[model samples]
Target chain A: MKLIDRARMKSPWVLHYNSGSCNGCDIEIFACMTPMYDLERFGIVNVGNPKHADVLLVTGPVTYRGARVLRNLYEQMPSPKAVVAVGTCACSGGVFRNCYNCIGGVDKVIPVDVYVPGCAAKPEAIIEGVLMAVERMSEHTPLKRGK
Target chain B: MAVKTILPFGPQHPVLPEPIQLRITLEDENIGQVLPALGYVHRGIEKAGENNDYPLNVFLVERICGICSATHGLAYCLAVERLLGIEPPPRANYLRVVWAELHRLHSHLLWWGLLADAFGFESLFMQIWRVREMVMDVLEKTAGNRVIISVNAIGGVRRDLSEEQISEMLHTLEECEKQLYALLPVMLNDYTVKKRTAGKGVLTSEQALRLGVVGPTLRASGVAQDLRMTGYAAYGELGFEPIVEQGGDCYARAVVRARECFQTIELVRRALQQLPDGDILTKPRGNPNGKAIVRVEAPRGELMYFVVGNGTKNLERMRVRTPTLANVPALLEMLPGAEFADIPVITLSIDPCISCTER
Candidate 1:
């Protein structure tokens, strides 16, 4: 109960990275920012630099060429950061999953914390994903020095 | 020896909506050169032409690009119809004009939203989408698809606009126009937006013509070269001139779009005013040896489709010369001399659709 409470209270900052997507997911992410949804009210600001972020919001199916870039970006974020795969494309490669150019979902490369599923997932669904990530974060204890 | 660094600008860039990769050669943030790589989402529609009959190709071609799908089918059909030597019925022509103009309105609205997005003007982006939603509702209620309106067939349109629908659309246009009029001051006269866009990415008339730049980009450079001047569709019956600007910069290009939005509204109202009554389509008489090069004024600029039929079920060649591809060299030309900070705004001013270009 204390862990969950701590997770909720910390209120991680987000960094959205588009690996390779149609703007559908990106626009919906911004839609989450507007007055109706207002994720900012929870201290979830989309910071420009990944180093400052605690939650990595990834959109689009990571394409063959973009896989390396995504890995580098994921590594850049500070420790204890959670990766939330937004949209079906990022989670399961959606429509472009099996295409010659696509490298499948982000899970193929990184450990995703929560999956937000939608063709271009609605803003409400995105917020729910964030909440889920927060809940998941509460369950984990930091790794020991050698472990 | 120091190896040169190649930066991949997209497949996912902050500014562009569609996925396109620019393999950029950079000498410390100043781009030395740009090489575009495309076909990330090629669905092999051109090859699909062999399987689908000529009649069904209309619906098939419309799926090429979500935003300009209608225009794609329209350009293709106009080519094929011209080969058969048949003019559409008057009612069909007027309806085509009305729908085409409406598409121009929605497309420009969409572009406006995207431009705002690229420049980080979030509030304006939302407002543009809000207005665009109203336009989409009109399209959905009329043609039944929010994005791809499969209304244009070979001979004419598939359906007719009822008097009530026409009146409703006109009323909607008035409301949209009022909203747009309200937005004009904010977009054009605003201090920050103008500062970001004005006098940036200047393409002179000489440069525009030399680069074969068409549509609004050309008009923005002070050239009066609209394909509509050729009067292919119902544009001749419903009279309007191309909107041209003299600035030849990003501001001029935006002004061209803004003026054309008003022109499109006026064009739709005119089409509604004198819409004649007749059958919508005629049966396409198959012609195997027909060939045509059709040009139309897309929201971007001049779009040219060259199609040749080999007296068979499929086309010999279906080549498209998109406006963005033409403007790319111009974009590169403007990019080299300008400061690095202006890249996003300059790119946005051209209003590129990489899918259309790549396809």
Candidate 2:
């Protein structure tokens, strides 16, 4: 009911991270920003800095070296944040399950709120994942600042 | 004088969405030395290829770089097919060309869009990607998926084009060609884009040749080398010619790709028009028992695949060489002595795909 919560529901800036993808899911995420899919219609904008973002859209199976960076990005975000794991690799390590470098799935490094499953998750499915993250954000109380 | 500083770019930079970190040392706003850090997106797909069955590796290699995935799939399939001593049907080879060229069309469009965004030309970025969706739609309609179509199989193609699909695809290409013509001129000749890209990352023909820069990077430097000219798959019959640019700068590289988009559309249209009538697939009988190597022209440049099989379903070894790997050293050579702010433009000029590199 507060002003911040109302604004949060109206718009959610999302951060996308490619821990160890083949770039399939990453390009689809990029497509969501383009004219055709246009995630802007839903008020979902892709941000670079983790601190200013509300929803973290993580793609790819977490690789050994990328794990540390992945953890760092997730921790930098403010409270009441949601992580959406995009693609089959990020969800459950689609084909790279046996690769020694990949620990497999975004959840291995961080808790995932929603999993959009595809080899390369389509823009439509990725939009659905962001919407799902927004819905979950409405359920939580916006964290009090300057605690 | 600006103070000397060490700046690490990416693994999470706004301009570069993919994972690649550039360690640039700056002296008074001019870059002194540059180093690239990798291993962020390494999935060890080469080893996975050795473990995965020969047929299944088609899908595995497709994941190497989603932008140019079909070329990866085609090269892998071609290598294994050679080892097995079976040729794909004639019609299948033509279909392979169709899909590969379509992938190139979309991949270059994506690169142009990203390059425009890198220099903060937001509307051009949006406009380029919008035209790109027409190619994506045709890919999805024919190959049954957008980015990684997976239409290619070991012996031949897994999908077939019906009468309606062929007609629809041609209509889409006509519209796409029209839209691409309207937008690409802005990227090629506009003063603002020229200021940002022209002469920004000039790699002389000698430097590009010595560095073994492949694809548009090489063509931009006025070298006439394209793997497609070597005539693998249906390219021999298609009579393909490489697009060449003499500038060897970021603008020249962009021009090569811009022209390549039109060439790709023509190749696809010709292949579809000359569509041979027959089965799209043929099954190989015996397991692969020798070593074979195949090189194909990916959207970025040359994509090579080496496979060794010992009369078994599992490959003894599978090695891949992506074009980005060939272009990086040349990129390192281009970085020093350039303005620090031009880093993103110069870095993207090579169209670096670290995932393909580390794999």
Candidate 3:
């Protein structure tokens, strides 16, 4: 029972959500799964369900319409989940910060544990962010959403 | 009497990654109506374009669609250059074609892999993406970043290709093309692939013209109207022709893209062979002033950029009409009669880029 958190990190299923990204970070995140990057070798599977996810990878500046969906996705994930804001936009709204529809970064909608910063956040950075998220997620008490 | 069920297919879905909800009304397992609800990724980039300095807008527009950012950057540069009345040097023109073709090759490969994934062809998907990685490597080797290389500058490309880089790129392209051919039997001739894509979501040439569809979608429907024919950049000198397939169905669209991959490879080879030896940049004296409308062939279709400058750093108005936006109507037309099971496959067939559409 004590090792459950550690066990969870061993094989974490990731859920990727694109709130309002330009598809830059999202593609890099997807590229992580390809043969060259081979993220699956680490036992990280990109899942579609929020319930099955141990970590959430979000890309883009949260737009007004996407903010609700972002919050909804975060709230639905089981406790002890970690959110990694991938890309400059998700970390701090990047270039889309001043755009009319943008509501700023992912932190505005959900508690982000790690920030993977890049215009398109390279696949290496995204993989590191997910791993960092795994460590951070394990540190959570399993009772609360964020510490 | 058949009862209709309304189902929302993403702002978040497994098959199509980016968020664009489709309100699908199903009647007895067949899709009745699919109204695409697309406000999720709308960051108001057109408005943002007007706010940014003309030089900076190149980067901003590139972010509009990461998959084809290089093409987007090229189009924006072409537009602004026209406004400034200064042409990029000859070497810059040839280099632009090389990178743009590489961009198209990768984008089509990505779409090809995604289509395979959409139809549950897992191993095929992985194989195609593996080949795509070679293109990414070339882009990184010559330019720097993988996806958004930002090689494009105001008057010319930022990076120049070395002879070593050119030979290495050609070697990679040769290997990639061979791998693509090995996969072609399964992608085209395989019964399963055909079952999923053949005669599905067909848009006849007339309907295609009426819908104002662009890119492979139009080419699939037998319309040979690629903006590249108008010969922007180095396409004129390269003697390019649109890859047209007459099937006009989902399979045709897939075939158009598949055939286009080979054409793009040849284009890159030709452009590299004819690469002019000269300075790449021709420095612009002052801020751009006047109106310029430029359209270039993006991976998806025709990407149009209209910039109106007032002799200032910031443009008075910058309007971008992305290929995906033009193709959405064609997608809407194709969805009404498709089975629920085929929705994902049909959607993938168009290679829809919701980010580009909404941006």
Candidate 4:
């Protein structure tokens, strides 16, 4: 119902973190930003800093070390935030579930709003996932300050 | 008097697609020393390979790095095949060449676009990646997926290219070549690209050899060694020479990759013409029992797989030495004397794939 919220829905700045993926999903995510898929046409920009991001796009199964970092990134983002897990690895650990150092998927560390499942999670799926996250952001209430 | 400051470059940075930390100690804008801290992206795939069956490990290895997934699978399968004392059929070998070279083209194009981005030439970056989509399209048409094709099996390729598909691929490649040729001058002779890259991050031939750098990094420094010369997976049948440059700078490395892209296109055409009629797989018999070392020329450089099988479903050990790991030392050598601004360009020159290194 707010004016800023309406504009935020139109342009969602996404922060990408590779929690320990094989780079398949990460590159596909990049492909989505390039001229071919041009996810930018929807006003989604891949930002490097967590503070400026509205959506957190995570790829790869969360490795032991990546879990803490992933949580920190989630905490850093301002609320009305949504997390989209982009690949089978990030969704449910995929083939790396049994790996000794893996902590399963991103959800193991943080709540996931949307799950995009594919071996590498094609660019189209990633675009759809981000759109879903933006929609989720619109419906959900932001956490109250000093709760 | 020089002021010293420490700059931490990544684990997450805009310039890097993967996570790897470089601690650069700067003395008044000149890098004094560099220390690299890794394992941020390590998923323990090597240890995981010990639990999976040999056939299943093929898929596991393919996930190590998406850009060079085919070569990773090829190296693992080659090692396993050697252990089992069997070879993939000739048709499979030729098909492997086709797919591997396609991987090379796509990987190089991806790297080229990234390198352009590193130097702040955004339009050039877009142009290179746009042409790269044709290669990805051909890959998707021939194989099911875009990245991580998963075409390689234990004994041979999981998929086969039909006559019509081969012709379509050739047509796509020709179109790709035309686009690439038009853009080649911009990458090779453009003012901005040249100024940023030329004479920056110079690695001498002796330094390259002493550092044991592999692939385009070493080739750019004037060493003409490419693992494809070893005749693995139909490279011998389709003969070609390594593309070498003497500058040993970022520009030289870019030129080597750009030239190799064209070379790989030609290789794909030749392999298709010489493709034989036969089975794609040989149905590898018996469990692997013994150690075998296999090497292949990946898009980055030489990729090595060391496998130890114990006549059981699971392998005893699987150690992968990726090209990025070898090139890291070369990166360390190139960094100290360089300016802070050129760090990303030099780093991207080696095409650092931390996932592949840490895996």
Candidate 5:
């Protein structure tokens, strides 16, 4: 493993985006950051800017409008990026699957490296998903320099 | 002459957990006009509810807002009950109050933490959420889920609280109260918090009433109005009063919610003491054949569920008016004449739940 890859494994900055979810999963994500679940112990930081983020943590099924924004956020993140879809809604649209505005699941808009499924995914599950995404990040080949 | 600049905030921003776009027209640093663009989180759950059976709609409505899931489920059940001409057992009513108050306690703590984070108080945010986890544990032990506790059914609750669980809940509440009280000074009198919040976004009582604001936003502006006082579910049996503050600023809203957390804890204790022993569910004899309007006090404010039943398994229409929507206009009213830096703080003060608004 490269020195940079080892460093990245120790600390993975995350960017959270709520596509079109009920706030259940969103709050659970926040809970994961609290002292008890402390995703930060794994060297994770929730960054607001997409450019600075290494892992794109998305919650909720993609809504018609949210899909466009989700795609934009995913594209903005620098490569070696991993997307983790949190909650059942982001996995398979959950209950809002048949809703008119919902397009269903984060994968419908972008590739999700880790899928955490729960009505509102628990904090522990979210931490596990982030770890999985970091593993995916290590395996992913960095984008060609001049591409 | 001050230069005018348009600053776009959110759809995705650090201070907000949900997505909401604010197109702020600013003159120098002061906001001249603010236009909020929503629907970023719109899932059309109301439309989805129309196609589902009344029994199944409980889950649909509950997902409308995860923080206030219990109240949403209770409101839908109340509307459906009115349509079916049946009421849940008295014990169920008391149980609903217990869960609803627990929801309020956790939600207010969540908001308190977020508001602290908005002001850049990271340690306070962590401490508040640490205390909030106790309430979440209580909810999980009683309702079987943490955030979206699927406890409510169309007729009554799906599960009942055991004696051990109730005692454990009381002990936990005592711990929470101690922890919360310890932080009261930080929330109320911290110089940085007060400087950022007090007199920053002033919404006069008249302006609040005119804008049709509901919940703590309205109450903080000196309006003594809360749907909980109407005694929906088991509120009437309990001595309930609205928490009102006259400051009409971000600090007032914070104080209102802070005090409400203690109020809710007291309510849960009273509910447990008064809980009657009986069946939690009363099966509805037939499909709902009429239209009914049910309003319940969500953690945010008044949450109204209008169910139109056509004497079938499916509902004709299910309309939800969440408190966040009602408070938006009031938010627009509060924005102009405020500093641009204060926008996020004022926005969070309303506890803007865009998911609940757009849904």
Candidate 6:
């Protein structure tokens, strides 16, 4: 079980979803994977489909239409998954909190395990976010293994 | 018997950060037609600007679109400054140029990463973004905020760069240019990338002009037009002809941007060397009463701002003409003949920011 936990911590494949964001955080999040910050050294890969993903990196202030898409995608991911809400918009609705279209922060639609806050959080912060999410995921699974 | 097939490209597609829906009419995976429906994240920020005081409106406008936030703030300040007849210090003008080009680099690096993702060149996406981070770090160090630098004000910018800071920024940008230049050839001449992009979504010089595509899109189509040439800010002091490419395809657009990235680094370094000394801002004496139209080059394209201040605290009306919105009709024209699998890749060529457009 510890081995599974370690492997998940080491090689968590991510599926990023934007609930409707300004491109600031979205671009910063991508910057995390670029050559300088290179998250691949941690063995993280951004997979296209949610079903094969282990972590969900969400950005933006979830809008009304985005809420439906978010739930549909969240449901598609297999079990044993964690959601990391990146950027201020995803965490507390940021500047768009009172906008006509926003449906509040991501937590309104799904359970979020970790929150990284910034108008657009930096790449360094996003890397820290993925690691923190894995730590929280470990505490949730029970200690005893069934025979 | 015919069945209407539906495919949802994004709210989470690799090529874009904002949620945009394109319902494609497909005949067995061959795209028969495409329809785009935006307004997913419309914040009604334009209306918000009308309510907020002039000072507060500056902050609100910066959130209009994250990628072009600084430019939005710049255009708004310019419009308001014109109304008040305040010429910021000479140093402020040069400082604005430095930050604006830096913003251009960050924004273009972002667009480059998305372009790589659209083509499924994930590693390249990562590579470009890594370089992009250095520019953001520069922004943070200088402006004290990463995305919304909030550097520009109606009178002038708030922060000033010391000689040491200026030298450090110059050094940092030099390294970035070297690293980015090393990667440009592969992105331009790589076999697979060219095969995918070269002829796809061909917009000839004439077609681009007809559609009124601005910025790199127009430049790629061989139009020698750039609002920067209009001598706004200190651009006239550091002169260069427009970067033009003849092909007008996805490949040409990519070339135009790659070249501009290098040019921007040159511009920033030059501005630093020629950095003038003076006051940053001067308080305006009277109320703003007239409407004004201010145009500037945003990272994506030509960004124009229209503001009508009614001699009071609030603006009578405010309008933003975003580049993505102007280029949409052009993108719609490019989509019809493209292969079904290339829809996302081709659509992304315009660097769509639905939030910016819908605002």
For model 4, residues B1-359, the per-residue Cα lDDT tens digits are 99999999988888898888899999999998999998888999999999998899999999999889989988999999999999899999999999989999999999999899887899998899999999999999999999999888878888998889999999999999999999999999999999999999999999999989999999999999999998999999898788999999999999999999999999999999999999999998889999999889999998999999999989999999999999999999999999999999999999998899999
Going through the candidates in order, what is chain B's TM-score? 0.95, 0.98, 0.99, 0.99, 0.99, 0.96
- What docking tier does model 2 reach? high
lDDT of 5 by residue, B117-195 (tens): 9989999999999999999999988888998998888778889988999999999999999999999998899999999
> In candidate 1, what are the lDDT values of residues B213-287, reduced to their tens digit?
877888999999888888887888777798989999998888889888899999999988998887999878766
Model 3 clashing residue pairs (backbone)? B215-B301
lDDT of 2: 0.91
Instruction: Supply the TM-score of chain A against the true chain A for every candidate structure.
Output: 0.87, 0.94, 0.93, 0.94, 0.93, 0.91
Query: What's model 6's TM-score?
Result: 0.93
Return the top candidate by DockQ. Answer: 3
DockQ of each: 0.14, 0.84, 0.85, 0.82, 0.84, 0.56
lDDT by residue (B87-145, candidate 3, tens digit) is 89999999999999999999999999899899899999999999999999898888888
Colliding residue pairs in candidate 2: none
Off by over 4 Å in 2: A142-147
lDDT of 5 by residue, A60-104 (tens): 989999888899999999888999999999999999999999999
lDDT of each: 0.77, 0.91, 0.91, 0.92, 0.92, 0.84
TM-scores of all predicted structures: 0.78, 0.98, 0.97, 0.98, 0.98, 0.93
lDDT of 4 by residue, A17-125 (tens): 9999999999898899889999989999989999999999999999998888789999999988999999999999999999988999998899999999998899999
Local accuracy of candidate 2 as per-residue lDDT tens digits, B1-359: 67899999988888877888999999989998899999899988999998888999999999988888899999998999899988999999999999999999999999999999999999999999999998999999888888989999999999999989999999999999999988867978898899999998899999998999999999999999999999888999887998899999999999999999999999999999988999989997878998998988888888888889999999999988989999999999999999988999999999888788887
Q: Positional deviation of B276 in candidate 5, in angstroms?
A: 0.7
